[model samples]
Target: MLFRFLVFLYPVIRTLGPATAALLLIAGISLIGYAVLRQPGLWSWLAAGACLLSAGLLALLCHSYHWWLFKLRPHGSLFIPIK
Candidate 1:
């Protein structure tokens, strides 16, 4: 019932792709960083962790997704029929 409706909507939402998720995460981190920076006692550790997390997210979003890049030849074989 509800699951079917949500599943139908999944592709339409995913059409916007990973960049949107990365951007949203970056915005959230920015807000958190601002709040943490304002606090006097917990500034250093919170800011460091937030910065590391944001950097990791950015790195993940920007990287190539191709998993078969190491080989010189194309991954497809004649024996393996196309789906």
Candidate 2:
């Protein structure tokens, strides 16, 4: 029963997570554009770029979650998915 539930949930999660990350990235870019129009300052761009970079990094981390789990662990006691 649990296996079936997880099987169903996986696709839902796979679809939702990337969409959420994409929305975050879009919001970051739009904010940067708005900031440029409003203030046109160097420091503002730097800050907005930092925020955008962080969001991109977060999306990357999500995509590489299994790799990170394997890398962070001291011993390989569990099997990490290649997919």
**Predicted model with the maximum TM-score:** 2
Score residue 42 of candidate 2 by CA lDDT. 80
Candidate 1: the clashing residue pairs are none
Candidate 2 matches the true fold with a TM-score of 0.58
Q: Point out where model 2 deviates above 4 Å.
A: 1-20, 79-83
Q: lDDT of all the models against the reference?
A: 0.48, 0.65
Tens digits of per-residue lDDT for model 1, 32-55: 666667744466456656665765
Candidate 2 CA-lDDT value: 0.65
Model 1 CA deviation exceeding 4 Å by range? 39-83
